[model samples]
Target chain A: MAVNDMTKLTLGPIAYHWSADTRRDFYARIADEAPVDEVYLGEVICSKRAPFHEADLPETIDRLERAGKTVILSTLAEVMLKRERKATEDLAAMETPEIEINNAAGLFARGKRPHRIGPFMNAYNEATIRWMAGQGATHICLPGELPADAIAVAAKAARELGLGVEVQVFGRASLAVSARCYHARAHDRTKDNCQFVCEADADGMPLRTTDNSPILRVNGIQTQSESYVALLPETGELIANNISHLRLMPQAVDMVAVATVFRDVLDRARAVDDADAMLRSVCRTTPFSNGFYHGKAGYRRIAMASPA
Target chain B: MSLAELICPAGTPAALRTAVDAGADAVYCGFQDATNARNFPGLNFTPDELAEAVVYAHAKDAKVLLALNTYPPAGKVDLWRQAADTGTRLGVDAFIVADMGVADYIARTHPQVRLHLSVQAAASSPEAIRYYCESFGVKRVVLPRILTIPEIRQIRREIPCEIETFIFGNHGLMVEGRCSLTNYLTGQSTNMDGICSPASEVDYARHDDGSMSSRLAGFTIDCFGADEMAGYPTICKGRYTAPHRPEAYYAFEEPVSLNLSRLLPQMIDAGIHAFKIEGRQRSKSYVRNVVSAFRAAVDDIRAGRTANIADLVALTEGQKQTQGAFETKKWR
Candidate 1:
């Protein structure tokens, strides 16, 4: 309630596998054109894709930082094997850019160092957020599954803790992360020999219900919503509350244009309805969903006349 | 001569007593509240009943582990704190916790109480497990059902805590303590509200062809053929259609219960300290039967004899069973 017009815009770590050139070009564009204030850089989904883009991390970080954007390196969402553990340690060992922790292992590796808590860390309540702050988390991105009321509650708690609260205002909502790769399994390929199958689906493989209803999306081990979470109608309430940072997850769309529309709505230069229409036109992604923000089914889109 | 302890589930006080009398080494349950994962209707013990159940289990030389595992809402952590406090007062053996806040509270409030990292924590790596052990003095961890025998063996050598594993029931493929598919449909999460495929929303209908269709909160989860046994309407078990596939298939996982009875000896050799059976919503007869059967198996393994595994086919959900990810990682 004491915050400004709205929160700063932040871009979450990309959860897909884009080609090396695509990753380079995407960050290049994000650094030069996007309206995001902070950009998270790293492989947060699968470790196999890290090497493909790992070589370009320095350039990407430099590009973003030189463009006056804060950079945070994110760790994998679920770390299990020795290789993944080493990857987390490597990220923690970095000196220039701070780390965003998605797995609990990052807490151990980044001992006492200031870090950001990614949405995958499950900071559902005040106690969890405060504990993360006590452990040196500078910012905490609450999961997309939280309703608007829960978001406001956590944002207030984060404000009290001096930790920024981030909400995922765009992109497909991640539902679950598993050890098995359904993307690879679908092709009768094992995870070890996945052969980079997930790269084929630039965004993510769409999974529909038996009636051809888009229900879930598979990106290797992570299962996400088949719909994109749109919060244009509720951004006012989010700003009226104490949300500190609004995160726009990178999807396979005209992301710069998408961010432009969101930035315009935040600046009041465009009405929410016009911005929503522009967003829908630019994002050739899935249907819109505001269910998680309203404490309803996550895949449905519901119109609200008044904010809670 | 105590091999791995046989841990069983008990939703009711009667079931708890039945498990203890049937020869369980330990029985785990939760209070009838959101603090536990099995927050089903007409299931779980009351706080007063838990006190009596703990006494009964202790009298029968069985341990009582209270599951206070669900993640509380942003401002409503009192429910979880109260559950932990009440369980501690009842003299439970260990508290199964998932949320970092709840674990921190338990570790600070009652440092003497044993804390077991619930599978809901999804701490699969050695570093994650070591973090819990170092931060909260967690004595044990219920390993998630996503690891293989070799992976478990390697993890055991690396972590400081004793490992408890699910040996039977709910071979759920979705990562435990992390799934929100149920919430995506019914607005109730297994991690927060502790209910999934909630009974209030589940409906079953018989088709004209004698097949059965199961729905959860008005969404069709799955349908079964005439001979195919129907399963609970969990989102993961339902068939889905994708653009790449022509017909609907089990995109997530099939309806199969985890039956690790055949792999008990290997698991014991793999250095598991406790073998857990999941099913807090089951009946006392089911608890008694399962406890008695697993008791004989663990006793046989202790005596250096091959355990005679029972055919629990009839008791399994969907009338199907699988070794799950414990034997291999390709159950899908």
Candidate 2:
């Protein structure tokens, strides 16, 4: 596939604080088996998780790149601490394995060096994307909440600026990131001594409404949807609008098979209905939602009308 | 030591007058349209009212900082552009902006008007603050309510722009400009649409046991007992259940307000250039009371006297308040 092709499948950086062994194995499988065109590596959620997986980054990058995948290093989404700043600076200084900046600190440190704007960066509109392009951003991942109309506008602006536009096609949509760690707070602990409680729930800790309905998932400081955003049916519209890439955030499921299903649908070798069933089986119990694309509540699964 | 300027919220023209009269150094407000974050029914100032507000505030020796903070949707950049143009024409002392596109437009077109980075920008780190300062010539940045006093002091030392920290009202625990929780449930973005848990989508139901439940778009945000003081069902402040806990709890933050009154002396000593108060959706009386309290507190601290802080528990949400993330990072 061409680098700028609309069918390009990119894997987003893991938002959960998975163990180093789990991360290594996950990336190894993605490198050798997944049909993804690009792979985003590094910690995007909590800064504390970086140390656990930073040592194995070089090997992971090499393996992914050797497997003919374009590798992108993602920076932390919420940068506040001294070490977080230092981490962003160190990542910004890197000349290889293009950086995906999630915070303005990365934008500052990178300073007009070509990079990708991560979904957390809030490239919500044409003006923002244009300004991002001016800041030397080569690609922009539109925030998951943006509806179809907004996506069309943003994608057109990005295309006009000669920048790649990517949208999250599958995975739990990140809703919020805070300075305070709800994951630690949930365990009755402070972030300073979080004891890596988030590692126990590799996908994310399930957070339900008071009435026993699961509404959100808490991963450290970040809040995400309980349902994975599956936009396979909307891929045709996205491609027609010139969206350059489709992103899949790594959940605790069989992501390689998930990528294969999306690839098959994108390639038109399989029907969206068939791929949808395949994804449901691969994900097992997690529900799929496409409401954000349809401009409804993110958790609502707006079913597309069946063909005549 | 130079006393930190007391910036106050003015949701309406009446609120603006009340704030100015109550000794606000500057009153920040937004237009009635979606250009600002406080987009609610019967709140915020019209352009003509803003023009009059500028005059009224200027006469009282207080500045009017226009908030054009929300991100302009695609193909609708003109709304924000026109807002900047109107604000410049109306002689707004500064433009409180969040989006890079809006900031860039203001900096380029209205170079003479000062640009204050809204907390909605979420420029928490020194590097992030410096980028805004250098690129857009931002004069002041309203720091997000997610930093500790030590972190603010560190950032103040590193950055060139003035730092403004929230001292009272609305404990904004979530990282602003980045949160999409409200959007996820309501399909109205807090960053793009400027309202969170919009009143229009909110519904309250009464149960047989004399209990009440508040919801947003059919999703149960929280339920309250008869004796409990029910707060607005904001996504962050609502109660939730986790597997680790036995029952439902305030998963994100409790229904509490942020009152940094006790930390006034320390905040002033830390070289904070301005002290901000949230709640542009509040009433004129709320504006008057908070501004008056903070104004007196700031004055007392500046004069080397112990600040006689007023009890503001009645005005706080759920009748509770916290210093929250300002005193320590362990508040989580």
Q: How well is candidate 2 docked (DockQ)?
A: 0.79
Q: Tens-digit lDDT track for model 1 on A1-308?
A: 23234468888888998999999999999989998888998999898889899989888989999999999899999888778999998888777536888998988988778888988898999888888898889888897788887788888999998888889989888898888888887877878889998898988998776545677888999898888988887888888788878888899998999888878777877878888889999876569898889888888899969633
Flag clash pairs in model 2.
none
DockQ, all models: 0.67, 0.79
Model 2 chain A: worst 10 consecutive residues (lDDT sum)? A1-10
The residue-level lDDT of candidate 2 at B277 comes to: 90
Off by over 4 Å in 1: A1-6, B205-212, B310-318
Give the poorly placed runs of model 2, Cα more than 4 Å off: A1-6, A305-308, B310-318
Candidate 1 residue pairs in backbone clash: none
Chain B, per-candidate TM-score: 0.95, 0.97
